[model samples]
Target: MKLVLVRHGETASNVRMVLDSLPPGPPLTDLGHEQANVLADALADEPVVAVCASTAVRAQQTAAPVAARHGMAVRVVEGVQEIFCGDLEGRSDREAYGVFVKTASEWADGRLDLTLPGGENGRQVVDRCLAAIERITEGVTGGTVVLVSHGGAIRLAGQALAPNVTASLAAGGLLPNTGRVVLERDGAGWRCTAWSGVDIVVD
Candidate 1:
């Protein structure tokens, strides 16, 4: 099974520097829609069997075009959602961004117990995300699956599972919106097939 994990397009909260990870978080900005279209076009020929997205509004919006092209419904899976922001949900300060980046990095480094105030632990996020993917591609022998998720979730999980693939994606310790990585099922784990943005027009 091959899973293409994509980050949702940018939102107003993104520019505001706010940590908006919850559902109905923030709508995509105009540029974000354009980014989504580009992402869809990039995967137009990818034999996508199923399109899954986080419950967050932005993730759904990002996955809609791709699902439409393939005539598949966007499956809103629970485990693939963004990292919970907890007390830093509404902050737009550098401190908030710093903490977010640090937490994600730590999670990638295998700090499963780490989390923000009132937030979920790294183990919780990765286990659920992988479980959701496993359930979706349970019986599929060879096919592609598209997953629209958040930056934090994708960065930490993608890097953890596919270190070499996400190496370029680590820009100042954050992932660019709409960037995606392809992973193939390897035994009980995953292996990166294509690093994020190798053929992408945008970084």
Candidate 2:
């Protein structure tokens, strides 16, 4: 099984730094739509058998075009939703930076027990995302499965497969808006095939 995990396109929350400020879900911005288009074009040729996305609006929007082009219905998966940010939702950057830094620091230091106020810890996200992947891979054998999700969820999914990569994956591992990373599973386990997004031009 090959899993292609993609982060949603840029959103108003992203540009305004209100991502952590807003609620858990928000629709994509105009630029986000453009990013989605590029991403859809990029994966148009891959033999995608299943398309799944987080219930969040941004993730759904990001997966729509690709699913449409592939003629596959998207299977909404709650497990891939962004890390629950709790009280930090909708707060300004200045107000949230300290919390983000703190959580990130703990993650970097290998303290998996630390959880953000009213939010999920890294380990929880990793476990759930891996479970979701396992479920998705059950029947499918060879074709790619595209998962549209948030940055944190993407990181968690990768970490589930490669626990030793926690620090590096948490250190902003180049998954820009609509970016993708591919992982392949053999008899042993999942292995990363590619990292980051590629430019796709559609005529």
lDDT of 2: 0.76
Tens digit of per-residue lDDT, candidate 1, span 1-203: 78898999989988877888778688889999999999999999998999999888999999999999889899988888888889888898888878877776666656779878888888888788777877887898778999999877876677666545444354334557898877887776677765555642222
Models 1 onward score TM values of 0.88, 0.88
Q: Which candidate number maximizes TM-score?
A: 1
Those runs of model 1 whose alpha carbons end farther than 4 Å from true positions after fitting are 160-173, 199-203
Give the per-residue lDDT digits (tens) of candidate 2, residues 62-167.
Answer: 8999999899888898677887777787776776868865685566556767787887787887778888877877888888899998776786677567434446
For model 2, what is the alpha-carbon lDDT of residue 193? 60
lDDT of 2 at 76: 90
Which pairs clash (backbone N, Cα, C closer than 3 Å) in model 2?
A: 21-89, 21-90, 21-91, 22-90
